[model samples]
Each structure stands twice: as structure tokens, then as C-alpha cells.
Target: MTLVPYAGSSAPASASVAELRPRPKSYVSRIWRHGPNDGVPLFRIDAAIDPATIEDRALSAALAPFAAQLQDLSIYVLHAEEVKPLAPWAVGRLDVDEKSAHVFLHDYLAAPNGMLMLNLFQAPGAVADIVMGVAPMVVEPRRIHFAITDYDIGIRASIG
Candidate 1:
């Protein structure tokens, strides 16, 4: 499936912006409708993160679960100056879960300067809610910061 948004979609204040709010100071996250009028809306999360780890095997190392559940994957890298002027991504869905999508976001932030509009087309349910039920894990933190240059998300069917 493709992910994107129509015109006036980049305003960040549009009605569609609601799900993307409560965003991180340098990040944005939310969930929204993912189909035609009759389609179900899946949860979506976005973050502008560091691109350092991109091309490294480590990036894919932790993707086992995500890949098992992922229908597809796409990523974009934005330089510092292009953070704004981001166009809304036009995206479409196959069948997906929300939990997978949210967890994908959480993992995405762990990636080292990049902007990820992750569409985990699997409704895995709310992982956060379930995690809150369990004891938290302890691990060393590895923070990756992004320097966005420009951002945009518009849809286009797979060309393969």
C-alpha cells in the first residue's frame, strides 16, 4: 500500500493533524483513517530521527518481528533545513494492525537521522497499554537525533 496526504495536509493543524499531535518537540505521531470511506483507520506514528544507522546491518537486525508483520516498508531522509514544508503523505492500506504500527514507531525512534512515516499495516493492538501492564525493561538508552531538511508524504502505487 501507498502512504500520503492531499493538499493542505501539511499544515499540521488540519483536522487530520489531530492524530499527529501530542507530538514530540522535534517529532510527530498519531493515528488516522487508512482507507476509503468504508475502510478502518489504523494507528500511525511518525518521528524525525537521526539517519546515522541507516545503511548498517543493525538497522535490519531488530526488524525480525516488524518484518514478520510488516506488509511493506519505506523511509526518507531529510536534512536539517528541510524539516518543514513537508507535504502530507498519501497512503493506502491493505489489512494491518495498530499494535504493530505503534511498536514500529517506538523502534523507529531508536534508529539513528531520518524521518519515518511508518505504516505498519497490521493492527497489533495497543502495545503501550499492554506494556503498562508488565514490568518495564531496563536497558541502556541510545538516543538518535534527526536534523530534518524537508519532509513530504504523498501516495504512489508500487511500480514493480
Candidate 2:
């Protein structure tokens, strides 16, 4: 079964989900609850959101201007992922098309600013620090995020 994203503006409110997911009555009144102070769950560390509307070529097109303005540097694309065969039961008909929907996907790019941005939208705070700590800081990147919004045929990009 294909799991689509939670399509809504805000998350569902509390009371409305009584039938769907019940919360303990004491949840409201109790200050001290019964739970373990476990560390954060292991989620995808390197995650990214791609332009919702643009395709591969358009994605490149939108970034062309930025690329030109950039100081010709080699960008390293790092992918943190796991690969496994598609399960027949969950694969469904679309599985034959061979596209699995995912939330996080990103590519590294070199920019003219002499600073590497974690991504187009927002760069991880430590990226610059990591780069600077290495040694001879020769090239820096000016990262940018070009917004893409239409997925029907292609994507539309915007500079936020």
C-alpha cells in the first residue's frame, strides 16, 4: 500500500481524534506521566525536500542562473540511504513504474559565495564550521534554494 503524506494544513486537533487515536484521560491533568526519557529516535539524518513542482530538467534550469553566478566549483552530492528490494505486497501496480515516494532527498552544489550551504533552502548550522575547521580554506560556497512548486507536468521555481 502506498502511504501518502499527511495532507492537511495543521495537524489534527486532540479531541477530534478520539475514535482514531485515544489518549489516556490522565493525559490532561497529570503533570508527571509514565514514560521513559529515551533519546531521540533514529530518523534520517541527511534529509531534504525537493521542489514539489519541477522535474529533473527544470530543476536544473532553475538553478542555471545561480550556477552561472557561482564561481565554478565542484559540488559533492552525498546520499545517506538504504536500498532494498520492493516487497510484492506493498509494491502495488505503481511499483511496476518503479518510483518510491520519499520525503528527504538532496544534492550538494558548489556556489560562488565561498561557503557551502547544507542545501538550497537551509544549510545545516555546522556545515561552515566543519569546512572551516579542516584547514586551508580555499573555496567557499554561497548556497541558495530555488523553490519548485508544480508536479503535474513540471516545476516552478522561486528564490525565497
Candidate 3:
């Protein structure tokens, strides 16, 4: 699976003028394969943003192509302050309505200085079982933690 960002240079209304401007940093794209001969390929794209900014529409546009292929979507707000409360809310929204979850995620991503990570999984069976098994932990305030780590590692190893 491949993720491609928008090629246009226009900035979203929420973004600052400086963010849309080009920078002098060198751009690099690399594909890395780990483990054995049949290892899964991991693609990493890094950019230097002077003042970290994320545009909601741009993110949504970039992900639109993969919407049909995705079986599960996980969004994490890495901000230390928000993670605690957001965990249960995320799980509840996901259980009730996935579209509403996406809407909330887009709004959160558009906020200034928002640190977020999104994981999209194509395989459903194993991942869905793993997610359901840990559904309780996702809602428990004291045990709020990402439940996909185990599934991610297992999938990578199995693919290899």
C-alpha cells in the first residue's frame, strides 16, 4: 500500500502563510525492508516544518484514495494532556459511528501544534479480533494505551 500527499502548493485556510512556502532543506524518500526475504516494506516520509502545522483538508484529501482499502483506522493524539480523555472518546465514537470519528480527527489535526498519528490497516480479520479483544483496555482510564502494537508486530512478522 502507498500513501501519496497532495501535489498542489496551495495551503489550507487554517495553515499559516509561512507553512505553505518552500524551504531549503533536502527532500528524501526511502523504502526500507527489514527481517527476512519476504519482509514487509516500510515507507517513511520526513519533512522539516519550522513551526509544526497540519492541515485537515490536506490530510483528508491525501487519505481519500485509501478509504476503500482500509479495514481499520486508528488515530492518536500524542499530546500528553489530551491522550487520557481522548482514549475513551475515540473508542466510543468508533463503536457508534466511524464517520463522526473521522470528522473529529480532521478537526483535531487542523488545530495548531497538534501532534497526531494515524494508522490504516488493510487486513481485517486478525486486526479486528485483536482490536475487539482489547476494547475494554481502550476505555479503561487507567489502562488507556494503544492496543494495535501487538497486532502490528505480528502482522509484520507474518508477512515476512
Candidate 4:
């Protein structure tokens, strides 16, 4: 799989923004929809986070259960401008579980500075519902302040 940017230039809002209204300032969530029918769910967390940080490991651990159930899991990193725009990088499909999730995270961690996008493909349920369960674990008290960037689920198949 390849990481595809959400094309909507304007900020799109969703129920998640309302639900997150009470939380601290950084818990912002951006929702984007792509695909002919907008059927896929791509969740992004934009934050001042270091991919190599230990907190990220915790997140992978949290998602271990879901990854096992999923046919494929991809984590993409888009470079966010603290000052200027930079190209984003993605670490494609990973084999995740309780034991190997930590290792897979390291590949993503190698990116210098970027937003995190977690894409779950071939999942069996509703997109919105799955994201609701995922949004909470993405936040941390001090390590990183996560902003949900987009929910657009458009991805390109990797060509060999």
C-alpha cells in the first residue's frame, strides 16, 4: 500500500471534533473522505511527536489486538511544517501483534518530523466506529499532543 494525501484543502469537521471539545487544546481531529463512496477510514494524528519516542510504542501495543484481526496495517508519516513544508514519508504494511508491534513501530519512528496516519485496510466494520475507539489511546499527557488530521481513506496499491 502507498500513503495517499487527503486532497481536501479546506478543513472538514465531524462528530469527533464535537466530542473532543472538552479535552485540552491539542486533541483536535480532522476528518477527510476519499474513494468513490467514501467507504474507507484513514485516521491521522498530527502532533509534535517524535516517531522514535517510547510513547509510540505504547500506542502500537494498544493496537496489537486490532492488528491481529486486520488483514493489513499501515502507518504513514507526513512531514508537518513547523516552519516550512517538507515531503512526507510512509512505512507501509506491518506485521503487528503483541510481540512484534514494538519492532514494527521502529520503522515508522525513523522519520524525522511528521504527522502520523494509521490506516487499517480490509477491516470488517464501520469506519467511524473504529476510529472512535482509536482516538482516545492516541493522546498522551506530556509526550505528545495529537491532532486528528484526516479520516480520508484513499490509498494506492503498491506496484511491484
lDDT of 3 by residue, 1-160 (tens): 2212222233212221111111212112233466567432222212121212324343333334334322233333222232233232232112112231210121232345322122322333222111111111223212222221111111211342
Candidate 2 at 158: error in angstroms?
Answer: 41
Better of 1 and 2 by TM-score: 1
Writing each residue's lDDT as its tens digit, candidate 1 over 56-127 gives 333223222344233222222222232232222312111123222222222222234223333322223312
Model 3 bad stretches (over 4 Å)? 1-72, 77-80, 86-95, 102-160
| Tens digit of per-residue lDDT, candidate 2, span 57-144 | 4333333334333222221222322222122111100000012212111211222321222232232222211110000011112232
Candidate 3 whole-model C-alpha lDDT, 0 to 1: 0.24
Would you list the rank order by TM-score, best first?
1, 3, 4, 2
The C-alpha local distance difference test score for the whole of candidate 4 amounts to 0.27
Give the TM-scores of the predictions, in the order they appear: 0.20, 0.16, 0.19, 0.18
Model 4, span 1-160: residue lDDT tens: 2112233333324432311111111212344466677532223322221223323355444333444323222333332321121112212212233332210122322343212323332223313221211122122222211234332222233433
Alpha carbon lDDT of each predicted model: 0.25, 0.21, 0.24, 0.27
Better of 2 and 4 by lDDT: 4
TM-score of 3: 0.19
Which predicted model would earn the best TM-score? 1
